[model samples]
Target: MDLFSLKGKRALVTGGTHGLGMAMAEGLAVAGAELIITGTTPTKMDDALSYYKRKGFKAYGYLFDVTNEKVAKENISKITKEIGEIHILVNNAGIIKRELAITMPVEDFRRVIEVDLVGPFIMSQLVAKQMIDRKEGKIINICSMMSELGRNSVSAYAAAKGGLKMLTQNLATEWAKYNIQVNGIGPGYFATSQTEPIRVDGHPFNEFIINRTPAARWGNPEDLAGAAVFLASKASDFVNGQVIYVDGGILATIGKPSNED
Candidate 1:
């Protein structure tokens, strides 16, 4: 059991105030790591920080935008200088805009790409430099089921995620000898604020997901906990450049609606 522990580790997660990022933060916290979660809003960060502090968990929050390379570098550097080096990083900040390619504005597409793809690249590069000097670290990128397959009106999101998958591999290839493990989590549809609109529209989406997935259900955020902990802990010392999908068997299926349940 202790083999999966992250005791004495310090972790940083971007966009960690809500949804999968928040879930990942909690998972790391429960695994005994001190957590620093970043977001753009002070209120949300404060709320998350307050909750963890009240729970007697070691947690903090910073208002920073990962898309801003200058701020990302400055704040992260400040954090390491003040609190100690962050041994783990979860690149979980991202955005999506749904529109047909023909009608999609180039600016909107670029916005998604900037936040989703470019932001992670910069964050990983900056953090990997620190990790390289230390010769040990864990970096987890939050990819999406889109990394494997695309859906309608989300070409930019798919493209960004797909790029992230390869980026994870590339980073692992270059940094493995330095003792850094770079991996990604490609999540399927999970119940979160970001997905609440679709979930509330109910039947069509639920039916589609249940029939599509062999597991016959939508995933919850908690479903990703063990994977995050494993990748962050010493247990994954040999794991690198991998994208683990937590999609309730959605990715494993073909065209058939497997109603095994």
Candidate 2:
């Protein structure tokens, strides 16, 4: 058997219109799974679907707000019916507010929590029901370095991700008996279009990230593909409740002083 192959599987990736989510979805597709991605806007959905189609990959897109439980449930049912049984789910939909805790509005904080943490809870629960009935599934939650370490101006995001880590664990514990594996992927800084300005050769944050990470560079979105595929495929059947940090060994050491070398 090709243990890593995802043939005959159908995957649902939330917030996969672009960036890291789209990268992971592409990985699953390359591994032979049919892809269904969710986005909040029809334009983004259509564009993403077209992008995949142009690349000769079979992909579908749906417009839905993952944070709305009713919408999530309804859409998930529609997907299962119209597409196929979703054997893999990637809860990549999330939001982050880069406001200082003391100055951040309560509503903004709540909104981040709702989208980042609560949304995943609802999505997982709805998808797990079908998996439970089938007695097999894989769930990958897109966590972050915030899940373990905290940074300035992102308190709400940190709290939500920290909660998501535990949520991944709890779901794994509860669903393992039914052959469901719940895991998280904690990505570090990646060099995406959104980070292009900061990724300049001598930018302060760029310097910090290069020095901080043992790999000495920002991660490419494609860097996450293997991890995503592993967690989404039968290759990870025995793994459960783990958060694989794809941070280029940043979490492994504090850092070398600038003067040390």
TM-score each candidate: 0.96, 0.98
Cα lDDT tens digits for candidate 1, 1-261: 888898899989999988889888899999999998899988888888988788688987888889899999999889988788889999999999999999999999999999999999999999989899999999999999999997999999999999999999999999999999999998888888766666654568766776787776778999998889999999999999999999988888784734444
In Å, residue 122's CA in model 2 sits off its true spot by: 0.4
Q: Candidate 2 has what TM-score?
A: 0.98
Name model 1 segments beyond 4 Å from true. Answer: 200-202, 258-261
Query: How close to the true structure is residue 131 of candidate 1, measured as C-alpha lDDT?
Result: 94
Clashing pairs in 2: none
Best by lDDT: 2
lDDT for position 203 in model 2: 88
Compared with the true structure, the alpha-carbon lDDT of candidate 1 equals 0.90
Q: Candidate 1 has what TM-score?
A: 0.96
In model 1, which residue pairs have backbone atoms overlapping below 3 Å?
none
**Clash number for candidate 2:** 0
| Top of the candidates by TM-score | 2
